[model samples]
Each structure stands twice: as C-alpha cells, then as structure tokens.
Target: MNLLEKGDDKDIEALSGLGIVSDDKSTITKSTIVEVELDLELEETLKKFGLRLESDGCLNWQMDASAHPRNWSVSRRAFNTSVLLALDLYTTAISTSGPSMAQAAMKEMDLGHIKSLIAFSSMYQFGQALGGVVFPPYSECFGRKAVYIATTLIYCLACVLTAEVPTMTGVCVGRFICGIMSAVPSVVVEGSIEDLFNMKSRVWIIFLWACATTAGLVLGPIYGAYISAYCGWKWVLFTGAIVTGVFTLLLLFIRESRPSRLLAQQAARLQHEKGLSYPIHSADATPNLATFSRIALIRPLRLFFTEPIVFVCSLMMAVSWALIYLFAESLPSVYASLGFTGPSTSLAFIPLLLGIPLSILFRIHDQRVLGRRECANLALNPEQKLTGFVIAAPALAVGLWIFAWTVPPAVPHLHWAVSMIGLVLVGFATNEFACTLSGYLADSYTIYASSAFAALAFLRAILAGVFPLFAPRMYSAMGQNLASTVLAAVATCFCGAALLFMKYGKTVRQKSKFAGHSLVVNRATQVKGDNVE
Candidate 1:
C-alpha cells in the first residue's frame, strides 16, 4: 500500500525505457513516488540538456539556463522596474486620493453620499482581506508567478470596469474587485526578494520595497490631483489600466519561486533521466498544501485564536495603518478648511515626501543595528526579535502625541512638517518591526509562512476598514487632539502587551505546536555551529 512501492512517484521521463510494472489503480499506492538515481553518465547527459535532480527522486529537465539569461538576470533595474509598476498600480488605484476623485465624479452624477462612500471604501479593504485568505493560499498551492499574472489580469479588468461604471454601486463593485486583485503585489515583493538574495543582504531590498510603496503614497495624490483636475476621475482608473497593462506584459518573463513547485519540476527532470514517462509529485511534503481538507481553509483563523504574538503585532500594525489612511483621507478637508483648492491639495503631500527620506534613514539604522542583533538572537532564541519593537513603541507614541497637539491654527506649516516627520518615523519603525516579525515567523516556521501572513493581512484589513469609517466622525466628535490621544493610548496598550510578551515570548513560542519544534531545531543548529562544523 506504500505509494513509493508502486513507482507512482517515478518520474515519467525516467520511465521512458523502463517498462511499467503495474498501472492498475489498486496495485498503485495512490499518488506516490519511486526513487531511482541515474548513473553519472546519465546525469551528465541530463545536465547537457539543462536538467536538475531533486531530493524526491525524480528528474526535472528543462531548456538550457543560459538560453534564458534574461530569466536569471536579477539586476536592481529589473527588480525596481517591476516594483515601481506594482506600487504605482496599488497606490494610484487604492489610495484615498483615487477614491476621493471617484467620489467627486459620483457626486457630480448625484450618487455620492457618506454612507455609500464609506461602504465602498470598507468593501475595498474587506475584499483585500478576503483576497489575503484566497490569493496567498492559491499562490502557495500553485506558484507565485502564476498568481501574479492572474491578479494583474484581474486588476486590469476591474480597472476598465471601474472607469466605465455608471452608478456608485457599480463603482463599489469595481473597486472591490480591484482591491482583491491588488493583494498579490505585496506578497510578490517578499517572494521576489527571497528568490534573489539571502537574509544578510535582503534588508536593502526590503528598504527599497518599503520606499517604493511610500513613494506611491506620496505621488498618488499628486497624480490623482492632476488627473482629477484636468481629465476627470475616470482618468484615474484609465491611467492605472495603461500602466498595469504594460507591467502585465513585462510579467511574461517572471520566474517562479515557490520552493516545493520548483523541487517538483526538478524531480520530473531526474525522472526523465531514469526513462520514466510520468514523474510522481510529492505534494504531501509541503505543509501549506499537504492537506486538502476543510481544516486547511480555516487554518489562519485557528492561528488568530491560538497565536497571541501574531494577534498583538498584527493589531498594532493594523491600527497604525488605519491611522495613516485616516490622516491621508482627511488632508483634503484640512486644506479646504484653510482655503486651498484642488492643485494645492496635491502639494500637501510634500510633507509626506519629506518624511519618507527621514523614515528611510531611521529604518536603515534599525536594520543595521537592531535587526542584526535580534536575528542573531533567533539563532539562540525566538523572542529576540520582539525586543526591536521596544524602540518602535515609544517612537510611535511620542510622534503621535506631538502630531496631535501641533495640528492647525495652533502651529503652522512647520508644525505640520514636524507632525509628518513624526508620522514617517513611526511608520518606518512599525513597518520594520512588522517585516522582521514576518521574516522571523517565516524563518522559524517556514511551512506556515503563507497562512500566518494571510492571517495578519486579514486582521489588518478588517481593522483598517472599520477605523477609517469612524475617523472623520471621531475627529468631529472628540477633536483631533482628543482622538489622537485616545489612539495613542491604544497604541501604548499594545506596547505594554508587546513588552510583556517580549519578556516571556520565547517561553510562549516554545510552547506552541507550530513554533516549539522549530525553535529547538534552530537553536540546535546554532549550538552545532559553535561546537562543530
């Protein structure tokens, strides 16, 4: 009954000359692999034909590697190019500026109202959260490249529909579709960097990715301003479509990075060398897709209930994200209160622009000093990364408090600049902490990375959606200072909760089924390195 015993796992190419022992259904042990090593001469021949063997005992033959120099060539240019397009699409299509323009257009059509606008925006976030559940799982089930292409196509289609939508409800539908499709780029950014570099060097790539995302936030308003001013709101959607189309075409050359899938392909080639006509796949090896049961659908939800660390960190980051969106959304009203029209509203993003460079500097410091120290702790213990957030917690609190007190009539443009600088600092630190947390989770629990990330994304989106709907009302009711003070208190509570875990987080991780075993293994590796080779 052993699957391997029946040669179901044998590479089809490897069985080309080897006769089939048994093809009967019951005689075979379902989808199992057969192990067979090729002779040195056969291996050499396979290499000549551009093939590689995997541990699953199969052959994966493909075209020559050099035949696709462009595929393997990973320059900063190519990475940045893809990154820029993805970010532009995300920022231009999803940011407050984009929606505000669409709202204006809808109002001109007599269909705009606060409830509908809020619902539409909330749905966008909800769609994103829902997509986090679906797309990441599907990407892990399939491969990153395929998912990227599919999402890009979907996004393009949605944008076309959005631009031409006749009613507010249709607009909401289009935006929700666009939001769902938008989930892939963030996932792809992490995957792409992992494909290209090792951990030590990945910090820079992360920095670049973060900056690109921030730049989109700044530039979205600027471009949205111009588009909304000159051509109308439809051009906002139109511009996104044109840019996304070009990027989708560029995606024709992207390579896959899913390790299990790549390993399967290699196994197929190894089987080819053994003359097997059909190579067996080892899907059971991957934790993410090993079980195709209903339980798998709710794994992330299970994680939410069980993993306190994931819950706290994701909640903190989600609150911060919502606040960022709230600030961005209200900027127009703030400017209008001060008598600025459409063009000048775009100029307001200059503060955000100035803040980004400053944030990058802080992020660089956090990575070089704090991140290294924490990651090294991971080799010894899992809780070390949580310490890095200690610095971030206060930075966020102070920045928010200062920004709250300094807004409007009391201070001036300089105060606004300082507030932005403060916000950028907190944003950068929060981003760094979240990124490192995710990386640590991935390193410690490699198999559960997609689901864990999906869980975080889902929660963050839910919070982000709800927070924005209440933001204007909260500010109106409580005033900016009081609302910010309240948010600061909430953030402080998170910090306090985070600190408690930082003190005991390793013990906590060591108790969880998902993390405990990995912690021991990683610690063993470090101890082994210290004692032996």
Candidate 2:
C-alpha cells in the first residue's frame, strides 16, 4: 500500500478533521502555520467544559491562547529554541569526545580490549538508532514539550552515571542510555522549530542549529583534550550533566505544540473534570502508544527502501556524516605530522568553523529567493526548497576531492593553509547541503517529517559511529590520500544521485499520495487567493 493509505496518514489529516486540507485564508502566506477553524459542533462541545480549539487545532482552555507554543512571542520562541539547540549541541560533543578519552579511560579502568573502547562510543550510536525509532512516535502522541523535558532529565541522569563510575562498562552503559534519552532533542527539536517559527523566519534558526552541531563535533576534541590534561575525563561528563541540567529546567516552560496530542490532553481533562467524553475523538481515534511505536520503528526502514527522495537524501547525509568522523580521525594525524600537538591541535578545526558564518550567509540569500517567489504568487513545492542542496552537492564533491589531494601521503605534507582551505570548503558546502535537505524533507513529508528524519538519522548516525572505529586502520592501509579519494569518489556519485532527485523530485513526490495531494491543494488555494484579489 502507498504510505498515504497507512492509518497514520489518514489520522494525520484528522488533526483538522479533513484530508490534506489547507486553512481558509485568502492572504498570500509564506508560513505553514495554519489557523484551522474548528467545526462548530467540536467548538461548542469544548465550550461545555470551557475548552476551545486554538488556531492550530490544539485544545486550549477558553481564552488561554498562550497555551499554544506557536502563539508564543518571538522572544519566547527564541529562548525555547536556544535551550533545545544547546541540548542538541551537547549530544554531538558527548559522542565525538569519546575517542579522545579512550586511551586515558582504558589505562585508568584496566580495560584490555580496544573494542571495548570503541564500544564506549559506538554503543551510543547504536542506542541512538533504537531510540530514534522508538522515541519519536511517543513524542508524536505525547507532544514535543513533554518529551524534551522528560528525556532531558533522563539524559542528565545518564551523564551522572557515566561521570561517577569511570569504568569502561559503567561509562559504556551510561553512554548508551545517554544516547537514548538525548534523542528527545535530536529528533524533536525540528518539530519545535516548526512550532515556533514560520517558514521564512525559520531559515536562520535552522542554520544556527546546524552550526551548533558542527561546532560541537569540531570543538569536542579540544575541550575533551583539555579536561583530560587538567581536570580529567570525568569532568567532561560532569560538565555535560551541568549543561543539560540547565536546559532541562528551561524545557519546562515550553508548551505542547502537537495539535493531536494537545486535543487529546484537553479531551482527557474535560472527561476528568466534568465526566464528559469527546465525540470528535471517536471518528479520529487518538493514536495509542503501542500502535505509534510499531509504526515509528518499522516505517523508517520501509521509507528508506521505498521512498526515492528519502533514500537518496539518506545517502547524502550518511556519507557527509561519515566524512566528518573520518576527518576527525585523520586530521589529528595530519596536524601531528605538522608538529602541532596538545590543544593547538584544536586549531586544525578552525576550517570547520568556516561552515558557521557561511551557512548564515547562504541562508539569508535563500530566504530572499523564497520571499521573492512567494511574493510573485507562485505555487511553491518542496522542490523549490531544495535549491541549496542542488548547489551544495557538487560543491561538497569538489571540497572532498580538494581534501583528498591536499592532505598527507599525496604531497608529503602540503602547506597547512592548503589543507585548511579544503576543510573549510567541505565544511561550508556541507552546511549549505544540510539547510536545503532538511527544509525540503520537512516541507515534503509534513506529517511524516519526524519519522522520515528518523530514517535518515539511522543511516547517518550509524555510519558516523562505525566509520571512526575503522578510520585509523583504513587510513593506515589505503593511506589517507587514497582513502580520502575513494570517499570523494563515493561522495561525487551520491551528489549525482541527489541531483537526479532534484530534477525529478516533483514527479517522485507526485506519486506520493500525501505530498502530491499537498501540491494540488496548495495550487488550488493559491489560485483561489489570486482570484479573490
């Protein structure tokens, strides 16, 4: 069956109690923020218990518009995103920092096996794989705010275990648990972005979120090396605990944004207070935890194998992430060959910092393009959102090949400036690719965005986890230049794959009942709006 036939897809439409219905507004709008009208019967039923549907179809106590996260002020939204983004940053730092501590932890804990050391890190990714599948459906049923706050607390506790125990086994278990709990921010923050910002406004926020992820990975070694030198590796976990603890406190202020869950909560509250049950829920049953989990875990794999866009983009991200870990493993030796050691090794990552400001610039320009398109009253598709990826894909290939030829074994240690330039190019292009890929997926998938992300994350996260474990040996045997060249070749091929999707993406999405219906609906609405004007 097509994905639209899946019960989830139909129930997704039941949010506003119509299949793929656009909100009834004649204004030319740029954002997906819908001000859905509640059916009068549904509205009056809620009023009997002093509840009403907000503009997004979420139930709110009568006159309590502030209960909806979308209704939050810009400052409030910014604050909430900052807290979630910070938590996401911490996940990357904790994951990548593991290798830096491996030698020290093995020595102190008397662990004889090198595989155990790899386990300390890779197990986190494995756990994240499981969590990525399991947690998103619950968040879908429960709401993002509750999941973020709840999982963050659990994640903090896991950090405490890892910090206090200091044994390989203890740390590995804690790391795995930390990985599972951290999926809250990893998986749900995108939804939070949707809740908080409209389409145009979200561009920079997402750009910064990507910057923070890359910054965490690039900066992890520097900070981990510092703690290992002076304060000890345990302090690394201690610091993460402290940081996440603060963010968890902030997550408490975030309100529920899932319209379905918000309505369910309202229904339950009314039933408890006045002994009344809602009929709206009978036609569109609230997703129970069990059914949601089954779909969440199984659907991603199906989507990965079946959906062309999701599959291709999944490869794009998987290779991109693997290169990151590979770079993390290889760059240290490149700098060591240049006679830079200690924290100065961190300076090698300055090129990766190039991704940050460059991402912001591209985002600004892309938003301008999107704004112009919307103002012209053009019908927008997710294909339009993918313009950045189309540009970045080949650029990323070029950047990778640049790294292939510039670094060691290819030219007996070229100028540090040359290799750094290669790294900078890769970093910037990767960021641009990220901006488009994510926005396109979110726009195309809509109700299925988180699940689709979970699918993409599985490939990328697992690749990142496993690649570092073999990087040292791979670089040793094939040599850095040849190995990097091979990776570059693979990336170049994947870049082509992405372009194929870009050229034919509309046709692929048109075959998808959900996305295709969305396109028709949007075009009809826009045409109606133009006629009204």
TM-score of each: 0.76, 0.82
C-alpha displacement of 325 in model 2, angstroms? 1.9
For each candidate in turn, give its C-alpha RMSD to the true structure in angstroms: 9.6, 10.9
Backbone clashes for every candidate come to: 34, 0
Give the runs in model 2 whose Cα sits over 4 Å from its true position: 1-68, 111-113, 266-287, 514-533
- Which tens-of-lDDT digit does each residue in 1-533 have in candidate 2? 12232334433445435543443333212232233333545667777655664454444445334444555677877787888888888877777776666645767777753565465667777778778777665665566777888788888899899878877678789988988886667766766665555455656776777777777777776767678667887887888888888888888886676645655666787779767664332111336767755555676677778887888777787778667766666777778776788656657777876755666666767777767777887645556556667667777778778877877666774787787777787887666666667766666665566767778778877887788778888878998788888887877775676667768887888797545543443333121121110
Residue-level lDDT of model 1, residues 1-533, one tens digit each, is 54334454445433443554444435443343233233456557656645544456554433333222223445633664464346534643355454456445756667544555554466667777887777665666666777777787788888789778746777778878877877667544554454344344444555555556556655666766678788887777887778778777767666676544664665555456655443433332434554644555576677767887667656776676566556556666555545568667656666555544544554465456645554566333334444456666776777677666666644544434555565565555555555456555554443455666677778877766676667678877887667777877776665676577668776666677766653443333221121100
**TM-score leader:** 2
lDDT of each: 0.58, 0.68
lDDT of 1: 0.58
